[model samples]
Target: SQQGEEDPQALSIQEGENATMNCSYKTSINNLQWYRQNSGRGLVHLILIRSNEREKHSGRLRVTLDTSKKSSSLLITASRAADTASYFCATSGPGYSTLTFGKGTMLLVSP
Candidate 1:
Protein backbone atom coordinates (compact mmCIF):
# COMPACT_ATOMS: atom_id res chain seq x y z
CA SER A 1 0.00 0.00 0.00
CA GLN A 2 1.14 3.52 -0.71
CA GLN A 3 -0.47 4.78 2.46
CA GLY A 4 1.64 5.66 5.46
CA GLU A 5 1.21 4.03 8.89
CA GLU A 6 0.60 5.89 12.12
CA ASP A 7 1.51 4.68 15.56
CA PRO A 8 -0.39 4.90 18.87
CA GLN A 9 -3.69 4.30 17.12
CA ALA A 10 -5.56 6.10 19.89
CA LEU A 11 -4.86 8.48 22.74
CA SER A 12 -6.64 10.14 25.62
CA ILE A 13 -5.44 13.25 27.40
CA GLN A 14 -6.62 16.07 29.60
CA GLU A 15 -6.99 19.61 28.42
CA GLY A 16 -3.78 21.68 28.39
CA GLU A 17 -1.68 18.59 27.91
CA ASN A 18 0.46 17.82 24.91
CA ALA A 19 -0.29 15.09 22.39
CA THR A 20 2.12 13.50 19.97
CA MET A 21 1.55 11.25 16.99
CA ASN A 22 4.03 9.46 14.76
CA CYS A 23 3.90 8.17 11.22
CA SER A 24 6.12 6.12 8.98
CA TYR A 25 6.04 5.63 5.24
CA LYS A 26 7.46 2.90 3.07
CA THR A 27 8.52 4.89 -0.02
CA SER A 28 10.04 8.19 -0.90
CA ILE A 29 7.77 11.19 -0.85
CA ASN A 30 7.81 14.77 -2.02
CA ASN A 31 5.95 16.14 0.98
CA LEU A 32 4.21 15.13 4.16
CA GLN A 33 1.10 16.73 5.57
CA TRP A 34 -0.89 16.43 8.77
CA TYR A 35 -4.64 16.82 8.97
CA ARG A 36 -7.38 16.73 11.60
CA GLN A 37 -10.91 15.38 11.26
CA ASN A 38 -13.77 15.86 13.68
CA SER A 39 -16.60 13.37 14.07
CA GLY A 40 -15.46 11.38 11.06
CA ARG A 41 -16.19 14.35 8.84
CA GLY A 42 -13.92 16.15 6.37
CA LEU A 43 -10.34 16.76 7.28
CA VAL A 44 -8.79 20.10 7.97
CA HIS A 45 -5.24 20.77 6.82
CA LEU A 46 -2.96 21.49 9.75
CA ILE A 47 0.57 21.68 8.44
CA LEU A 48 2.80 20.59 5.58
CA ILE A 49 6.48 19.81 5.64
CA ARG A 50 8.54 19.27 2.54
CA SER A 51 10.99 16.41 2.16
CA ASN A 52 13.81 18.89 2.55
CA GLU A 53 12.40 20.36 5.75
CA ARG A 54 13.31 18.94 9.10
CA GLU A 55 10.70 20.77 11.13
CA LYS A 56 7.78 23.12 10.73
CA HIS A 57 5.43 24.82 13.19
CA SER A 58 2.12 26.65 13.12
CA GLY A 59 0.16 27.89 16.08
CA ARG A 60 0.17 25.14 18.69
CA LEU A 61 1.22 22.48 16.21
CA ARG A 62 4.73 21.31 15.42
CA VAL A 63 5.80 18.74 12.86
CA THR A 64 9.08 17.00 12.25
CA LEU A 65 10.27 14.95 9.33
CA ASP A 66 13.19 12.57 9.02
CA THR A 67 13.75 11.48 5.48
CA SER A 68 16.56 9.13 6.48
CA LYS A 69 14.08 7.12 8.56
CA LYS A 70 11.06 7.81 6.37
CA SER A 71 9.24 8.95 9.48
CA SER A 72 7.32 12.00 10.63
CA SER A 73 5.75 13.25 13.85
CA LEU A 74 3.11 15.75 14.84
CA LEU A 75 2.89 17.45 18.20
CA ILE A 76 0.13 19.55 19.62
CA THR A 77 0.92 21.81 22.55
CA ALA A 78 -1.49 22.80 25.31
CA SER A 79 -4.22 20.78 23.71
CA ARG A 80 -7.80 21.73 24.43
CA ALA A 81 -11.00 19.75 24.61
CA ALA A 82 -11.82 20.99 21.15
CA ASP A 83 -8.68 19.31 19.94
CA THR A 84 -10.42 15.96 20.25
CA ALA A 85 -10.29 14.58 16.75
CA SER A 86 -8.66 12.07 14.48
CA TYR A 87 -5.31 13.02 12.99
CA PHE A 88 -3.86 11.67 9.80
CA CYS A 89 -0.57 11.84 8.01
CA ALA A 90 -0.48 11.91 4.24
CA THR A 91 2.25 11.81 1.67
CA SER A 92 2.60 12.56 -2.00
CA GLY A 93 5.12 10.40 -3.75
CA PRO A 94 7.13 11.14 -6.85
CA GLY A 95 5.05 11.25 -10.03
CA TYR A 96 1.86 10.89 -8.00
CA SER A 97 -0.52 13.79 -7.71
CA THR A 98 -2.76 12.20 -5.11
CA LEU A 99 -1.77 11.79 -1.50
CA THR A 100 -1.99 8.51 0.39
CA PHE A 101 -3.18 8.87 3.97
CA GLY A 102 -2.38 6.86 7.04
CA LYS A 103 -5.08 5.10 9.04
CA GLY A 104 -5.25 7.86 11.65
CA THR A 105 -4.72 8.55 15.34
CA MET A 106 -7.80 9.26 17.37
CA LEU A 107 -7.25 11.79 20.15
CA LEU A 108 -9.71 12.38 22.97
CA VAL A 109 -9.20 15.42 25.13
CA SER A 110 -11.10 15.71 28.38
CA PRO A 111 -11.85 18.97 30.06
Candidate 2:
Protein backbone atom coordinates (compact mmCIF):
# COMPACT_ATOMS: atom_id res chain seq x y z
CA SER A 1 0.00 0.00 0.00
CA GLN A 2 1.09 3.53 -0.62
CA GLN A 3 -0.37 4.75 2.63
CA GLY A 4 1.69 4.69 5.79
CA GLU A 5 0.73 3.40 9.24
CA GLU A 6 1.29 5.39 12.35
CA ASP A 7 2.90 3.71 15.35
CA PRO A 8 1.43 3.72 18.88
CA GLN A 9 -2.10 3.84 17.47
CA ALA A 10 -3.00 5.86 20.54
CA LEU A 11 -1.19 7.97 23.07
CA SER A 12 -2.14 9.69 26.34
CA ILE A 13 -0.20 12.47 27.97
CA GLN A 14 -0.68 15.31 30.42
CA GLU A 15 -0.77 18.95 29.49
CA GLY A 16 2.63 20.64 29.32
CA GLU A 17 4.14 17.38 28.16
CA ASN A 18 5.20 16.29 24.72
CA ALA A 19 3.81 13.79 22.24
CA THR A 20 5.61 12.06 19.41
CA MET A 21 4.22 9.99 16.56
CA ASN A 22 5.98 8.00 13.86
CA CYS A 23 4.82 7.07 10.36
CA SER A 24 6.22 4.57 7.89
CA TYR A 25 5.43 4.58 4.19
CA LYS A 26 6.01 1.89 1.62
CA THR A 27 6.85 3.76 -1.61
CA SER A 28 8.76 6.78 -2.66
CA ILE A 29 7.13 10.18 -2.17
CA ASN A 30 7.64 13.71 -3.31
CA ASN A 31 6.48 15.17 -0.04
CA LEU A 32 5.08 14.21 3.35
CA GLN A 33 2.66 16.17 5.48
CA TRP A 34 1.28 16.07 9.01
CA TYR A 35 -2.30 17.00 9.79
CA ARG A 36 -4.58 17.26 12.79
CA GLN A 37 -8.28 16.46 12.78
CA ASN A 38 -10.59 17.77 15.44
CA SER A 39 -13.99 16.39 16.28
CA GLY A 40 -16.13 18.53 13.95
CA ARG A 41 -13.74 20.54 11.84
CA GLY A 42 -11.94 19.61 8.65
CA LEU A 43 -8.39 18.40 8.70
CA VAL A 44 -5.86 21.04 9.63
CA HIS A 45 -2.55 20.95 7.84
CA LEU A 46 0.28 21.03 10.36
CA ILE A 47 3.47 20.81 8.38
CA LEU A 48 4.77 19.58 5.05
CA ILE A 49 8.36 18.68 4.33
CA ARG A 50 9.73 17.91 0.92
CA SER A 51 11.89 14.88 0.20
CA ASN A 52 14.95 17.06 0.23
CA GLU A 53 14.24 18.60 3.61
CA ARG A 54 15.56 16.78 6.65
CA GLU A 55 13.73 18.68 9.37
CA LYS A 56 11.23 21.49 9.83
CA HIS A 57 9.63 23.26 12.76
CA SER A 58 6.57 25.45 13.21
CA GLY A 59 5.77 26.90 16.59
CA ARG A 60 5.67 23.97 18.97
CA LEU A 61 5.69 21.33 16.28
CA ARG A 62 8.70 19.63 14.75
CA VAL A 63 8.78 17.26 11.78
CA THR A 64 11.59 15.18 10.37
CA LEU A 65 11.86 13.23 7.17
CA ASP A 66 14.32 10.50 6.24
CA THR A 67 14.02 9.73 2.54
CA SER A 68 16.48 6.85 2.85
CA LYS A 69 14.30 5.19 5.50
CA LYS A 70 10.95 6.15 3.96
CA SER A 71 9.93 7.31 7.40
CA SER A 72 8.82 10.52 9.04
CA SER A 73 8.06 11.65 12.57
CA LEU A 74 6.02 14.42 14.15
CA LEU A 75 6.73 15.88 17.55
CA ILE A 76 4.51 18.25 19.50
CA THR A 77 6.10 19.99 22.40
CA ALA A 78 4.48 21.66 25.40
CA SER A 79 1.20 20.24 24.35
CA ARG A 80 -2.08 21.51 25.67
CA ALA A 81 -5.42 19.89 26.38
CA ALA A 82 -6.80 21.40 23.20
CA ASP A 83 -4.22 19.43 21.31
CA THR A 84 -6.25 16.28 21.88
CA ALA A 85 -7.10 15.00 18.44
CA SER A 86 -6.27 12.48 15.74
CA TYR A 87 -3.15 13.14 13.73
CA PHE A 88 -2.56 11.78 10.25
CA CYS A 89 0.32 11.63 7.85
CA ALA A 90 -0.22 12.09 4.13
CA THR A 91 2.22 11.51 1.32
CA SER A 92 2.24 12.40 -2.35
CA GLY A 93 4.04 10.12 -4.72
CA PRO A 94 6.62 11.30 -7.25
CA GLY A 95 4.19 11.81 -10.11
CA TYR A 96 0.84 11.46 -8.35
CA SER A 97 -1.40 14.36 -7.51
CA THR A 98 -3.48 12.54 -4.93
CA LEU A 99 -2.28 12.00 -1.40
CA THR A 100 -2.44 8.78 0.61
CA PHE A 101 -3.11 9.07 4.30
CA GLY A 102 -2.29 6.76 7.17
CA LYS A 103 -4.77 5.36 9.66
CA GLY A 104 -3.79 8.06 12.14
CA THR A 105 -2.62 8.43 15.73
CA MET A 106 -5.00 9.46 18.47
CA LEU A 107 -3.48 11.75 21.05
CA LEU A 108 -5.21 12.60 24.31
CA VAL A 109 -3.88 15.41 26.40
CA SER A 110 -5.32 15.73 29.88
CA PRO A 111 -5.40 18.91 31.84
Candidate 3:
Protein backbone atom coordinates (compact mmCIF):
# COMPACT_ATOMS: atom_id res chain seq x y z
CA SER A 1 0.00 0.00 0.00
CA GLN A 2 1.31 3.38 -0.93
CA GLN A 3 0.75 6.26 1.41
CA GLY A 4 1.59 9.89 0.77
CA GLU A 5 3.19 12.13 3.33
CA GLU A 6 3.94 15.80 3.00
CA ASP A 7 6.58 17.89 4.69
CA PRO A 8 5.88 21.19 6.47
CA GLN A 9 2.22 20.81 7.25
CA ALA A 10 1.90 24.55 6.97
CA LEU A 11 3.57 27.22 4.88
CA SER A 12 3.41 31.00 4.89
CA ILE A 13 4.49 32.96 1.84
CA GLN A 14 4.33 36.60 0.93
CA GLU A 15 1.98 37.47 -1.88
CA GLY A 16 3.69 37.36 -5.29
CA GLU A 17 6.32 34.94 -3.99
CA ASN A 18 6.88 31.32 -4.72
CA ALA A 19 6.12 28.38 -2.44
CA THR A 20 7.32 24.83 -2.66
CA MET A 21 6.26 21.66 -0.87
CA ASN A 22 7.47 18.10 -0.87
CA CYS A 23 5.74 14.74 -0.63
CA SER A 24 7.01 11.22 -0.03
CA TYR A 25 5.33 7.92 -0.72
CA LYS A 26 5.78 4.38 0.50
CA THR A 27 5.21 2.18 -2.56
CA SER A 28 5.12 2.18 -6.34
CA ILE A 29 2.22 3.92 -7.99
CA ASN A 30 0.58 4.26 -11.38
CA ASN A 31 0.27 8.00 -11.09
CA LEU A 32 0.50 10.85 -8.62
CA GLN A 33 -1.76 13.86 -8.45
CA TRP A 34 -1.84 17.24 -6.80
CA TYR A 35 -5.00 18.95 -5.66
CA ARG A 36 -6.08 22.12 -3.94
CA GLN A 37 -8.89 22.80 -1.51
CA ASN A 38 -10.13 26.23 -0.63
CA SER A 39 -11.43 26.29 2.93
CA GLY A 40 -14.63 24.21 2.77
CA ARG A 41 -14.65 23.72 -0.98
CA GLY A 42 -14.13 20.38 -2.63
CA LEU A 43 -10.72 19.67 -3.99
CA VAL A 44 -9.86 20.76 -7.49
CA HIS A 45 -7.33 18.64 -9.33
CA LEU A 46 -4.25 20.69 -10.07
CA ILE A 47 -2.27 18.19 -12.04
CA LEU A 48 -1.62 14.50 -12.60
CA ILE A 49 1.49 12.99 -14.07
CA ARG A 50 2.12 9.33 -14.66
CA SER A 51 4.95 7.41 -13.05
CA ASN A 52 6.99 7.57 -16.25
CA GLU A 53 6.91 11.34 -16.19
CA ARG A 54 9.71 13.23 -14.53
CA GLU A 55 8.24 16.71 -14.45
CA LYS A 56 5.13 18.67 -15.33
CA HIS A 57 4.13 22.31 -15.37
CA SER A 58 0.87 24.23 -15.52
CA GLY A 59 0.45 27.96 -15.24
CA ARG A 60 2.29 29.03 -12.11
CA LEU A 61 2.67 25.47 -10.87
CA ARG A 62 5.46 23.02 -11.44
CA VAL A 63 5.70 19.43 -10.21
CA THR A 64 8.56 17.00 -10.22
CA LEU A 65 8.68 13.29 -9.56
CA ASP A 66 11.61 11.23 -8.40
CA THR A 67 10.39 7.67 -8.45
CA SER A 68 13.74 6.26 -7.44
CA LYS A 69 13.53 8.30 -4.27
CA LYS A 70 9.77 7.89 -3.95
CA SER A 71 9.42 11.63 -3.54
CA SER A 72 7.71 14.50 -5.33
CA SER A 73 7.71 18.27 -5.09
CA LEU A 74 5.24 20.99 -6.02
CA LEU A 75 6.23 24.55 -6.74
CA ILE A 76 3.91 27.48 -7.07
CA THR A 77 5.65 30.45 -8.62
CA ALA A 78 4.50 34.02 -8.21
CA SER A 79 1.83 33.00 -5.77
CA ARG A 80 -1.01 35.20 -4.73
CA ALA A 81 -3.40 35.59 -1.80
CA ALA A 82 -5.83 33.57 -3.91
CA ASP A 83 -3.34 30.73 -3.69
CA THR A 84 -3.95 30.46 0.05
CA ALA A 85 -5.34 26.98 0.39
CA SER A 86 -4.58 23.43 1.41
CA TYR A 87 -2.55 21.40 -1.05
CA PHE A 88 -2.65 17.61 -1.10
CA CYS A 89 -0.74 14.90 -2.86
CA ALA A 90 -2.55 11.71 -3.80
CA THR A 91 -1.45 8.34 -5.12
CA SER A 92 -3.32 5.80 -7.20
CA GLY A 93 -2.58 2.23 -8.27
CA PRO A 94 -2.33 -1.39 -7.15
CA GLY A 95 -6.02 -2.09 -6.89
CA TYR A 96 -6.82 1.35 -5.51
CA SER A 97 -9.69 3.41 -6.80
CA THR A 98 -9.68 6.31 -4.39
CA LEU A 99 -6.41 8.10 -4.02
CA THR A 100 -4.50 8.01 -0.74
CA PHE A 101 -3.96 11.60 0.25
CA GLY A 102 -1.34 13.17 2.42
CA LYS A 103 -2.34 15.03 5.57
CA GLY A 104 -1.91 18.17 3.47
CA THR A 105 0.16 21.32 3.19
CA MET A 106 -1.68 24.43 4.21
CA LEU A 107 -0.40 27.38 2.22
CA LEU A 108 -1.00 30.90 3.44
CA VAL A 109 -0.20 33.66 1.00
CA SER A 110 -0.22 36.88 2.96
CA PRO A 111 -1.30 40.07 1.30
Candidate 4:
Protein backbone atom coordinates (compact mmCIF):
# COMPACT_ATOMS: atom_id res chain seq x y z
CA SER A 1 0.00 0.00 0.00
CA GLN A 2 1.10 3.55 -0.65
CA GLN A 3 2.12 5.39 2.47
CA GLY A 4 2.11 8.92 1.12
CA GLU A 5 -0.18 10.98 -1.11
CA GLU A 6 0.45 14.39 -2.62
CA ASP A 7 -2.33 16.95 -2.61
CA PRO A 8 -3.50 19.34 -5.34
CA GLN A 9 -2.65 16.75 -7.99
CA ALA A 10 -1.46 19.63 -10.18
CA LEU A 11 -0.27 23.18 -9.84
CA SER A 12 0.23 26.10 -12.17
CA ILE A 13 2.54 29.01 -11.50
CA GLN A 14 4.30 31.86 -13.25
CA GLU A 15 8.03 32.35 -13.38
CA GLY A 16 9.59 33.97 -10.33
CA GLU A 17 6.55 32.98 -8.29
CA ASN A 18 6.53 30.53 -5.47
CA ALA A 19 4.95 27.09 -5.63
CA THR A 20 3.89 24.88 -2.81
CA MET A 21 2.90 21.23 -2.67
CA ASN A 22 1.68 19.13 0.21
CA CYS A 23 1.66 15.51 1.24
CA SER A 24 -0.09 13.37 3.78
CA TYR A 25 0.87 9.89 4.88
CA LYS A 26 -1.03 7.02 6.33
CA THR A 27 1.42 5.46 8.80
CA SER A 28 4.40 6.32 10.97
CA ILE A 29 7.58 7.13 9.12
CA ASN A 30 11.12 7.63 10.20
CA ASN A 31 11.72 9.85 7.18
CA LEU A 32 9.91 11.43 4.26
CA GLN A 33 11.45 12.44 0.96
CA TRP A 34 10.46 14.69 -1.92
CA TYR A 35 11.48 14.18 -5.52
CA ARG A 36 11.14 15.82 -8.89
CA GLN A 37 10.90 14.21 -12.32
CA ASN A 38 11.16 16.12 -15.55
CA SER A 39 9.10 14.48 -18.26
CA GLY A 40 10.95 11.36 -19.45
CA ARG A 41 13.82 11.68 -17.02
CA GLY A 42 14.05 9.82 -13.77
CA LEU A 43 13.03 11.17 -10.40
CA VAL A 44 15.66 13.32 -8.72
CA HIS A 45 15.92 13.36 -4.98
CA LEU A 46 15.01 16.73 -3.52
CA ILE A 47 15.09 16.54 0.26
CA LEU A 48 14.66 14.00 3.00
CA ILE A 49 13.29 15.18 6.34
CA ARG A 50 13.50 13.01 9.40
CA SER A 51 10.66 12.53 11.84
CA ASN A 52 12.60 14.51 14.42
CA GLU A 53 13.03 17.47 12.08
CA ARG A 54 10.42 20.13 11.54
CA GLU A 55 11.88 21.79 8.46
CA LYS A 56 14.74 21.63 5.96
CA HIS A 57 16.08 23.86 3.22
CA SER A 58 18.32 23.47 0.19
CA GLY A 59 18.80 26.28 -2.25
CA ARG A 60 15.39 27.74 -3.07
CA LEU A 61 13.56 24.70 -1.80
CA ARG A 62 11.98 24.51 1.62
CA VAL A 63 10.34 21.48 3.23
CA THR A 64 8.37 21.14 6.42
CA LEU A 65 7.30 18.03 8.26
CA ASP A 66 4.69 17.60 10.96
CA THR A 67 4.72 14.00 12.11
CA SER A 68 1.92 14.65 14.54
CA LYS A 69 -0.32 15.57 11.66
CA LYS A 70 1.25 13.03 9.34
CA SER A 71 1.72 15.72 6.75
CA SER A 72 4.47 17.60 4.97
CA SER A 73 4.83 20.51 2.58
CA LEU A 74 7.35 21.48 -0.09
CA LEU A 75 7.93 25.03 -1.16
CA ILE A 76 9.88 26.27 -4.15
CA THR A 77 10.84 29.91 -4.14
CA ALA A 78 11.42 31.93 -7.32
CA SER A 79 9.82 29.39 -9.52
CA ARG A 80 11.10 29.17 -13.08
CA ALA A 81 9.77 27.66 -16.27
CA ALA A 82 12.53 25.12 -15.92
CA ASP A 83 11.12 24.17 -12.57
CA THR A 84 8.17 22.60 -14.30
CA ALA A 85 8.01 18.96 -13.34
CA SER A 86 6.19 16.36 -11.36
CA TYR A 87 6.90 16.19 -7.68
CA PHE A 88 6.45 13.13 -5.54
CA CYS A 89 6.42 12.43 -1.84
CA ALA A 90 7.77 9.16 -0.50
CA THR A 91 8.01 7.66 2.94
CA SER A 92 9.74 4.77 4.61
CA GLY A 93 10.34 3.60 8.12
CA PRO A 94 10.37 0.92 10.78
CA GLY A 95 9.43 -2.42 9.22
CA TYR A 96 9.57 -0.99 5.71
CA SER A 97 12.83 -1.42 3.86
CA THR A 98 11.60 0.30 0.72
CA LEU A 99 10.14 3.68 0.04
CA THR A 100 6.49 4.18 -0.89
CA PHE A 101 5.93 7.02 -3.35
CA GLY A 102 2.79 9.06 -3.83
CA LYS A 103 1.09 9.56 -7.17
CA GLY A 104 2.87 12.90 -7.59
CA THR A 105 1.86 16.50 -8.25
CA MET A 106 2.38 17.94 -11.70
CA LEU A 107 3.59 21.52 -11.64
CA LEU A 108 3.55 23.80 -14.66
CA VAL A 109 5.54 26.98 -14.51
CA SER A 110 4.92 29.43 -17.31
CA PRO A 111 7.39 31.99 -18.47
**Residue-level error in angstroms, candidate 1, position 62:** 0.3
User: Residue 111 in candidate 2 has what lDDT?
Assistant: 99
Per-residue accuracy of model 2 over 1-111 as CA lDDT, tens digit each: 548889879999999999999999988899999999998889999999999999999999999999899999999999999999999999998875689999999999999
TM match of model 2 to true structure: 0.96
In order of lDDT, best first, we have 4, 1, 2, 3
Report backbone clashes per prediction. 0, 0, 0, 0
How close is every model to the real structure, measured as TM-score? 0.96, 0.96, 0.94, 0.97
Candidate 3 lDDT by residue in tens digits, 27-96 = 8988999999999999999999889999999999999999999999999999999999999999987665
Candidate with best lDDT = 4
Q: Which pairs clash in the backbone of model 4? A: none
Cand. 1 TM to true fold: 0.96
lDDT tens digits by residue: candidate 4, 1-111? 887889889999899999999999988998999999999999999999999999999999999999999999999999999999999999988765689999999999999
**What is the alpha-carbon RMSD of candidate 1 to the true structure?**
1.0
lDDT of 3: 0.93
Off by over 4 Å in 4: none
For this target, which candidate reaches the highest TM-score against the unseen true structure? 4
Which model is ahead, 1 or 3, in terms of TM-score? 1
Poorest lDDT segment (10 consecutive residues) of candidate 4: 91-100
Q: Native-vs-model 4 lDDT?
A: 0.95
